[model samples]
Target: MHDFVRTPAAVVAALVLAVAAAATPAGAAPATPRWDHFGYDAENSSFNPHETVITPATVGRLKKKWSVELRSDQSCSSYGDPIVADGRVFISDYLGISAYATGNGAKLWSHDWVGSSNSPPSMAVADGVLVAGYTDCESMSDPNSGLIGLDVRTGKELWSGATAPLIIEIVIDKGVVVTAGSDIYNDTATVAVRVSDGKEAWRKEGRRIDVTSANGTVTGRDVNGTGTVAFDVTTGATRWTVTRNLSTGTASPAGDVFYGSSGDGDDLEAVSVRDGRVLWTAPDNDGVVAVDGTRVYCSDDNGIVALDSRTGKQLWRSDLPDHGALAATVAGGVVYTAGIALDATTGRVITGTPRLSFRSIVTGGVLYDSDNGTLTAYTVNG
Candidate 1:
């Protein structure tokens, strides 16, 4: 062995090394924020615009782009998720909708209406038209529903119309305006109207609007509100609404429309409209996350699991010891279940589940209300 030699200064420096290490900054780049809102996009595309978000290691740290908070005292109670477009983000409170500057979360405009706690989410901005839904208290069991159209360039109401619906979902197809809602038997639940003047072009005699696809096809339920229906993009005619339920996870790929229940139970099914067939189902399932073309990532409120999207086969699972999942999202070849990550190919937990800044992960990012509501973006890297 070589002879040992140490200077007095060198010995002193070694004792101070621990202090320096803890102060080191996270040596990773920040991740791009993801816009994974439900019911897809303006045209109902489940495909997230930020499709590259695949892995935990690849996810960069992120800060809020902007946010608008509404207290129930102010008219809403964390009741719904906000919608994003071009550069503006739209938020809906128990009262109505607000348009905000996405770059800075500044309030640009606000709209309101009195609705129940179970009010469905609604919003759309396309070709200079902004639309939102409103409830009709005319009847209790089956009331009329409608949408308000506004000038997309400026938050101004352009036109208003009636759908005779209860719950509504709006989308654009091939440059045409479309919206749907639930109605009674022999009821016109799904209706497509011209965005320019809010004129009825096609109205399915009986159906309910649940979710939509980018291509304009819609997925919904039947009269009782638990079956399934896929209405035409252009004519509001019935494509097909199977009896199965749908999966409610992260937004799906663009134009992949389906329906399923999320309140509870082991069964959650979502079919694709591209071919009008049952795409996948989770029978022994707990809750689910995002599904890429290849694999379906899922978790119970306790652990993470993987399934083959095409065949509904089990891939693998990992322990999520303390927390439950929020939504499963995939980007950069890694799968995110709630907050943890599993290798896409091996179904192994590569990273432990992360603590959430907030429980409402759908609206965008979450902020700690303690530190003056410090908004923290839930991302892979930054």
Candidate 2:
């Protein structure tokens, strides 16, 4: 019998280790910070797919983790939603901008703007900079509004520019910052500025803009009744204009779908993101719509309706008592609206559902709720 040369145990072990190391993925490159925009993402999906810890089965045992009170006033509503990114929660109210640690709710830093006039500054973050629109409600005139860029880490003001008047709804994409004016007389005037140094890049009149899933494209609803128009984000040039119907509210863009109102005042319409083709319509008057790419959640008069994102088919519906849902957002396979939690697939309220605040969002496996003047975080359990 020929004697076989046996491999050394140490050598075999080393070979196995190398093969296992190669098979294992490099500790999945740290996930990117989420909740960067008011609608949760640039496409305004308001969906957090990475939130695996807080599931429908586990949300019933959610416990309050921490809470922090934000500054606000009676005159100005703190309607600007807080954004979470880079392990920090950034919120804006009349008192100014503040940052808190996502894990401990510890105050990181705060910055106040001079002559901000007690208005909720539209806040967003891009390229490591927190961009917000400061409105001088006391003046309400030219130069009364400006865009400010701040260092996200230290809450330091990096740049500011008086680009427009009464800036509202600050949306950032790429390097361009779009600021919609709250001018009662001119809802159509929109401006874009460079986020790096707060420089005006372009401007357009008579166009209220909405973001889309595509980059460099924004939907502009004509205030003069010309219809819903699409414009270039960089040059303010009109790409296409559909004059058949009046568009209303903030457009919810997901993939190729743009969901908004049709000015008929009773229904929400889904249009093509490419050419504004009517895809579907549903009954809705003042309900806020949030999409998760797979499903759309809306607070309608009938209650919370979950529709298939691709076909707009009603998947399920749940009725809430108050119907005063502040914001409807989806994450962790659950739908949260007006302090209630519902299963995304079945639309049934989960048991032991914690009464959240009027507005809340699930991020990093924690639910953050803004109630009265305090922001509270909750730990969910199954």
Candidate 3:
């Protein structure tokens, strides 16, 4: 395995270089890419199309820019994945939800829930509002689960609205915030609320965990069984239902295609989001699926596998172990898995890439990784 070791002298040198790069002439700098949603967007695609840096050629030069200690110990937990928006990064955990400056890791603002617990919460940001879903600490059997909207710039509570129960996922699209999860009574639901005022727009029961919105529709898994369903984002009207059990987890949507695993075997399947038709299945390749414009990426027993999006043909496979738990984040023609960077087309590891001990997201020419109570930022040229 290729790795980059950072000694004390190397760290200081990297810091100086990062400071110098940040002093570049103002107008000459490119626009920084923003990851505004948990999975990068409403479709949970986990791919950044606007990234102009951190490509395979430059990934090996990545250096630590900043880091923040989220907690002192590992007993606590981080709620949802960290999201970057409007020059800041937001993260929720057992302590509370906090925002930090993406450039220097400075704390901008934070909000503490009255009765926060270990139960995970989901969050998404849009239109200057950050929507977070949480379960009150009263009782799990009859918990007061709901969504709260906060000012993304100031972290002030704007409004709160009720929802089903444990919110497994949240997505925002079409001027609404959509949430999906079930309660202790086994009543699963998908709820949508206005992003401006936290008012219920529509609610559909029987549609269970994990919701993703894109292309005028919201898709989720079934409540009682292992199927998938789609509904109109504005009116909660059923668009289509696929009875086939695609996967036990969430599916990543790219354009009109939904990619997921079957959970029963090493097969990654692609289904049409319009009609739930099985487009193709790539056998012996399954685990967290990420789709870009032309390829589908997933983790299997052997490592990371890339498939042709249209025909499900295996394009390339990288041989690595213990990668099944890491999701692939594609940006600038490179696939990032935990700490490894690989050529998206050829599946070759980029030598000297920093080996991170946790999952990471690359945006704005920097990589942000959080694990074991620490969030760190890396960049090739600050």
Candidate 4:
């Protein structure tokens, strides 16, 4: 947070950098190749072309171009940032997903997927087509939810189908749409769907699919059952499949191919990208929480903790808050975890305090939660 009274100039400079950084990348494939997923690339790094860490000195300087009220809907919880491609912003109003005029925020078209969402669905655009994922009310525990494709220019629904029984998330790798889901009723099967038409191109025979892909290779495993499988994205050929008894944690980092799993107790092991090898393991991580490239932040009996991405060693741990869910990201040169501030290098809680959500895309940063009723726009000071 910034003191509204002092160093207004410093605040302004920070805002400038932030505005300069908010620019998202798009490409010619969908006329919006720039946007890939959550972190704006398979790596889930959340770093855009201009996303260098913005600091406290830089936070206050930003400005709000304009805020859209997004037709007041009691049902919508806008957790994901708006995606862009071509000349429009692709977003899901609490009502449904729509393509809005990038400059004026005018509604061009929309496609609604009736799913119970905690966060907005992510988008993948390729070949002038748009693809997205949603938690299906239709398929609760199963990811056999739904995948919808829209003609980027017109709001016309090109294709919509059940790619997976429960599609927890979707990824666009090398122009193909890779989704995760496991149908419990039909046995256990994970599948990869083509983004252009909601078709199941390749699916795990009878195994549950919990894989994450980058460029094209699949990296992940089935949780609550078999570990997961590492596969070549191009041929669906298995690189490695694990039967190790463990809880499937966060899908491996898409690009680095780094995968992780939670053991019988509170333990986490980081797997290798070159080969399906256990690189390192951290002690007793009860809840293997958020996973990113630089670090893997988890919840444990010790409270929120941080581990080195490559070594799986505990870099920092702080008993900021125990038992509460933790959210984290590697930004501002620190592992910003919920309840505690794990020093980026040391993982010690130099700063430990409570915060609301969305404050900085970290756990405590939630400026206004869904319960807050109709948040028009969020205003923050560095």
TM per prediction:
0.64, 0.84, 0.83, 0.67
Give the Cα error of residue 6 in candidate 1, in Å: 66
Give per-residue CA lDDT, model 4, range 175-233, as digits (tens): 56666554556544556656667676777645443334544555555544566566765
2 or 3: which has the higher lDDT?
Answer: 3
Off by over 4 Å in 3: 1-32, 71-76, 136-144, 221-228, 247-254, 262-266, 323-325
Model 2 alpha-carbon miss at residue 80, Å: 5.0
Model 2, 68-161: lDDT tens digits are: 8787655543534578888899887666788999989999998876755445666677788888776665554454666788999999999986
Per-residue lDDT for 94-191 in model 3, tens only? 67788999989999998887765455466777788887776666665576666888999999999998665556566677778767676677768777
| Model 4 per-residue lDDT at 240 | 75
Q: Residue 77 lDDT in model 4?
A: 43
State how far residue 62 of model 3 sits from its true place (Å). 1.0
Candidate 1 weakest lDDT stretch, 10 residues = 1-10
| Model 3 residue pairs with clashes | none
TM-score (C-alpha, index-matched) for candidate 4: 0.67
Q: Is candidate 1 or candidate 4 better by TM-score?
A: 4
Instruction: Tell me model 1's lDDT, rounded to 2 decimals.
Output: 0.48
